[model samples]
Target chain A: MSLLEVRDLNTFFRTKHGIVKAVNGVSYTVEAGKTLGIVGESGSGKTVSAMSILQLLDTNGFIESGSIKFDGRELTTLTRREMYEIRGNDISVIFQEPMTSLNPVFTVERQVSEPFMVHQGLSKREAALRVLDMLRDVRIPNPEVVTKQYPHQLSGGMRQRVMIAMALACRPRILIADEPSTALDVTIQAQILKLMNDLQEEKGTSIMFITHDLGVVCQMADDVAVMYCGQVVEMAPARTIFGKPQFSHPYTEGLLFSIPRLDTPSDVRLEAIPGAVPHPLKLPDGCKFAPRCKYATERCKVEEPELVEVQPGQGVRCFYPDLKERRKDG
Target chain B: MGKYVLKRLVYIVIVFFVISFLMYALYNLIPTDPARAQLEPMRQQLKPEEYIRMYKQLRKEMGLDDHLVIRYARWMGIIKGLKGKFDGLLQGNFGYSQTFKKPVVQQISEPMKNTIFINIFATIAALGITLPLGVYCAVHKGKKFDTTVQTMSILGYSLPIFIISLIFMYFFVVRWGIFPLMGSKTPNATYEPGSWEAFVDKVYHIALPVIVMTFASLGGMTRYVRSSMIEALGTDYIRTARAKGLREKVVIYSHAWRNALLPIITSILAWFLGIFGGSVIIENTFSLNGMGKLYWTGLNTLDFELVLAIQMFYTVVSLIGSLLIDLSYGIVDPRVRVNK
Candidate 1:
């Protein structure tokens, strides 16, 4: 069994206007000792779906219906205390914008060491020593000096490393990193990605990596799940998804084609997926991507397609995910 | 930090002098003679010339006949004192209060004690309630407890303090008779001073006013605390704290509350220093002999010495309050903490 298996998860937020279907029937898995990257645009429920795994949604948000089984235990059925125990011990998370993710009032040692104190029942001094060890593992030089400093005192890259140190302190089995490198500059981003990958390897930690950066997914993800309007429209091995598969979801094709390539002619314009993700409250009734799909049929608008296994290990949620003139009309 | 405090202290002195000088000049210009009020009976008793001579001598003796600048300088102890001694304000001379018929410093004691007495309890009660209540409301924001408290606080906030005072007095003092209608203490209660009984008696007499004071001031602050906490809870750090799997209590109080407390320091300190300012409406409503009531009477009767002393006291307090507030930022949040 996968380390963390989230099945048919539907998370919704209760707003004054109506219920916002932030994550609707999203299902994916993070295998043991491997990285599963969930990629999407902003508001595609990437963060919300990750948040639901820990039941850490905002006050208004709730798991409408979901089965999150972690290590053969049903997380959706666990009591809050049980969930709390599982949170830092079995599953930990690192967020984007490390500058804001860390508590400014506390030193790096305090923030990084808190998981140890809370979960492992270690004394603050004991946690302090562990904090130094954890900080060093994240490759922060001068760990002692960095630990004593506040979050604001550190540079962005250093702060991101501190957040990683904090999340990995408890040696959690699965780490959910939400846009972890998006806020850093390109060089720092690459460094953080490498550090996360290295830490995962050393700790044998399964990772649920969520980001909109396809390049990042290609580098770090063993398998990739492309989400649109809360559902995973395509899931395949990283190489299959990035290296031009024979059969690919149109949305995935749109996402790949939209990347402004350096080898393309300078005068050639960039491609964009036509139309936006529909407002969550007013989503399309059928295949959600149908409105933007060039090959969308009248039937496609009336009937939603199931996420079907198109090949041995790949899944696509479209009537015509094939690109080689598989259409009957042709 | 030391340098900042020292700079503020110097500014305090300069600002205090300028404010006090203006007050003295303004009070003198009011054309109300505190001595003339004292000597009114003598006006009808003596010959006009004799009464005039006595009044002139009395004015000169009171330092009221001096030029405004000279009188201010002498009063502030920039020169040899009014009574041919260096007994100006700088040398611990607050002169005397015609209103209370005692030295200004001596008469100030009872009112100061009474005001601080009520305020300390009221402030403690408010904070004890507000800190937890605000954080709770923020955590459970938009829920029943939060919404209910929010509506009630709005009602409390909108109502003028005097009306609240009247409502409390009517219920507690007039209707229930659970507390005295007025005064800092029983006029002739024979509990020995500093004894437990005396303390209890003081507390009993001031209970209604304290309750009224707390109620009247509770809304603005609880709301302030709630909103500040809400903002704090919205910060990314709070989400990180919750994601740490800490218990709800630890997350709310330790992490979120610590962030919330930074902005709240100023309001709470302002509320604390306002203890000295006292509640004029509440004190007057209950006929309590607190600083607020004394200040009102001092101004109405033109008790120049009393007014000047209280004004100077507030100036120093507010100046010190601002300095303390600025210094506190560094303590609460390291981002604002300056190495120097």
Candidate 2:
């Protein structure tokens, strides 16, 4: 069985104006010792889906319909008290901004060792030892001195590593890294990603990697799920998703074409996605991405497509799956 | 760090000297003659020359006959422990109060004790009520509890201290006949330290005024704390704490409250130093013989020496309070230090 399986998860926020369907019927699974990347634009509900899995949605938000099963146990049915036991011990998450994520008042050692203290009930001395070890594992030089220093005293990259150290300290079965390196510089980003990859290899940890950067996704993800407007538009093996990418969903094609490559000449104009992601409150009927899709049709405008299998291991939600074939047929 | 603290101390000393000098100069410049005021009711028939002679003698006796520069120098000298009849600047005898007909420092001592007693208790009571309620309102924001607290805080803020005092006096003291209406104690009260009867009497006398003072001050601070708590709760670190699977109490108190308290702590210190010492209205309303009342009396009587002395004491107290606040900032928030 998969370590973590999210089935038809729906999360919405109750607001003054109306209820916003932030995460609508999103489903995916992470097998043991593998990486599942959820790629999308800013409001594509990737982060919300990940947060919902841990039941960390904001106060106004509620999971309307979902089944988050971790290790054959239903997470959605668990109480907050029960979920607390599994959160740090079995499932860990690293947020986007490290500088803000780690409490400024606490020393790096205190934050890094908190998971061990919470989950394992490790003694202070043992927690300290493990914190230092994890810090070293994340390739932070001079773990002894860094442990004693405050968050503000360290640079952004160092702080990110400390966040990672804290997250991985309890040896969780699944690590959900939500845009972990997005706040970092290019060099630091590569370093952090490499560190995460190395750790996953060493621990055989399943990872739910959420990011908009397709390059990083290409580098790290074994499976890719493309989300658009609160729903999974496509899912496939990473190589097939990138290489053969069936040019069916115009949204996916736009996302692929928008990625700038070094091989492309500097003078040549790059392809850009035409419109912004639709506002969640005013999401269009039928296919949410229909308004932004180039291959949108009358049928697409009236009917939502199911996430049906197009190939053996690939799923595409589209009314006109063979857009190229349709053009040839025309 | 040592150098930074030393620099701050020197700044404090300079501020102290300047304040003292200003108080001294301003009091001397006032048209009212302290000697004439002292001798007013006693005078049956006195010649101008006699009055002038008596005034000059009194001024000379009080060391006020010296030049402005010289008097300031002497005051600074006393403060620095270089030359003064007293052991040091703050050691008992600064000068005698002509209006009160007693040693200025000695007269202030009792009133100061009363003021400290009332102010400290009231402030502690206000904080005890405000802190938890403020935090709860912030955490449960938009809930019925939060709405209720916000409404109460607004009502408390709107109601003036005098109005609140009158209401309490009416309900608790007059109608209920539960507590004393005014004064720090009943007539013919004698000191009996550690006695339960004495403690109960003192508490009864102090209750109404303390309640009035607490409600008057609680609104602003509670609002401040609530806003700070809200800001702390919205911070990324707080969300991270929740993600860490910590209980709500642990997340709110240990993570959020500590960070939120930096601003609240400083404001509380300021309120303690400023309001407690300057409670002239409350003291008069309650008929409490506190430092505020003493200052008010001294000012009304044009007792320059007594006024100047009280002013100087208040300035020093304020300076010390602020210095302690700055030092505590470093302790509470490790990120802040003497240097930055």
Candidate 3:
């Protein structure tokens, strides 16, 4: 069995306007010790779907219908106490902005060491001793000094490292990192990504990586799930999605082509997918991406498509999954 | 941090002297004569020449015969004591209260105890009610309980304190007859002063005032705590805390409360230091002998020595409270640097 299986999850939030379908029927799984990157633009429910798996939805947001099975145990029915145990111990989450993730009033030692104390039942002193090792595990320099400092005293990159250390302290089976490196400079981002990858390998932890950066996905993701309007449009092996492929979602194609390559002609403009994401409250009737798809048809505009496998282990939510044929016709 | 406190202490000392001198000078400008106010009731019994002699002797003895600058200097013990010993504020001689015909310190002791006693109960009740209720409201924000508390508090907040005080008195005292209507003690009821019986009787007598004081102060404090807790609870760290799988209690109390407390410490400290001078309105309404009412009486009687003593107490309390508030900001929030 896959280590964690999230099946047909529907999460919604009750706001002043109406009930928002933040995560609509999103389904994926994380295999043991492999990285599954969920990629999408902002407000695309990449974070919300991940938040759904852990039942970490905000007070307004909740999993309306879903089944999350971890280690052959159904998660949705667990009591709050049981869920608490599974949270830092079995599945952990690191948020996007490390700058705001660590509590300001608390020292690094107190925050990072808390998981050990909570999950493993270690004493505070014992937890403190383990914190240095956890900090070093994330490759932070001066682990001893860093543990003594407050979150504000450290640099942004250093704080992200501390967050990773805190997340991985209990050696959790799965780590859901929601754009963990997005707030840092490119160099620091690269460093943080490398650290997360290294820690994942050392601990043999499954990772559900969420980010809008496709470049980072190419480097880190074993498999990629492209999400738009709260549903995954295309999910396949990184090789199948990034490399020339026989079948892919048109939305996925648009995302891949938007980046300017080194060999692209200097005179040519970078190809960007036209139009913004439709207001979620007023989503189009057919395929959610139909409004922006260059090759959208009358059928594509009238009938919603289901995620169907056209190639081995590749799923695309489009009537015409054949990207080469669609390109030729255009 | 040490340097910051030392600097504050120096400023406090300078301000204290300036304030005391200004107070003495202002009292000198007042038209009332302390000796005449004191001896007026007894003047009919004395011969006219004898009365004249007695009045002059009393003025000299009271140090009212000196020039304003000399009197102030003597009062502060800035020069020398009148009788080779320092008999001014510095030497713990608070002069006298002509109205009460007693030493100012002795006269003030009962009022001070009463004020502190009432305030102690009020403050404790305020802190106890606001902190937990506010936190719960924030946690269950937008829930039925939160909305109910919010609406009720807003209603309570709009009504004037006197209205609340009178209403409480009417209901608890007049209608129910459950509590005493006024006074800090039961009239003619005998109990050993410091015994358990006396303490219970005193609390029973003061319950209405304490409740009124607490109810009057409760609305603003609760709302303040609620908003502060809500802000703290909404921060990214709180999300991180929840994601840590820590129990919800730990998440709210330990992580969120610690940050929420930074803003709250200022108000709590203010309330604590405020116990020295009780609420004048509440004290008067309840007929309790608190410092605020005492100070008001002193003002009317132009009891300069008594007023000056109270003013000095306030100045000292306020200065110490300021220093603590600044230092505590650093203690609660690591971002605030105390020394620099």
Best by DockQ: 1
Model 2 RMSD to the real structure? 2.9
Tell me how much of the true interface, by contacts, candidate 3 captures: 0.76
lDDT of 3 by residue, A48-142 (tens): 98877777788899889989899899998899989999887889999989889999999999999899999999999999999999988888899
10 residues in a row with least lDDT, candidate 1 chain A:
A321-330
Once fitted onto the true fold, the runs of candidate 1 whose alpha carbons sit more than 4 angstroms away are A326-330, B1-11, B33-69, B190-196, B273-278
Model 2 agreement with the true structure over B62-118: per-residue lDDT tens digits: 566667877666654553332444342445456667777887878888788888888
Which TM-score values does chain B get in all models?
0.89, 0.88, 0.86
Residues A1-330, candidate 2: write the lDDT tens digits: 888899999999999999999999998989899999999999999999999988888889999998989999999989889989987678889999988999988889988878888888989999999999999999999999999999998999999999888888888899999999999999999999999999999999899999999999999999999999999998888998778655445667778778887676788776888788888899888898888776677888889999988887788888766657755643
- The parts of candidate 2 lying over 4 Å away from their true place are A265-267, A326-330, B1-8, B35-67, B76-92, B189-200, B337-340
Q: What is the lDDT of residue A62 in candidate 1?
A: 93
State the TM-score of candidate 3 restricted to chain B: 0.86
Kindly report the docking quality category of candidate 1.
Answer: medium
**Model 3: per-residue lDDT, tens digit, B1-340?**
6676667678878888888888778877878888888789999999999889999999988778889888888888777766766678888888788778899989888887877778878888988998899989988998999999999899777887679988998899899999989887778878888999888988898898888778767777788899999999999999898888999999989999999999888887766664444477778778888777888898888887888887776766677777778778767887765225
Extract clashing residue pairs from model 2: none
The local lDDT score (0 to 100) that residue B230 gets in candidate 2 is 95
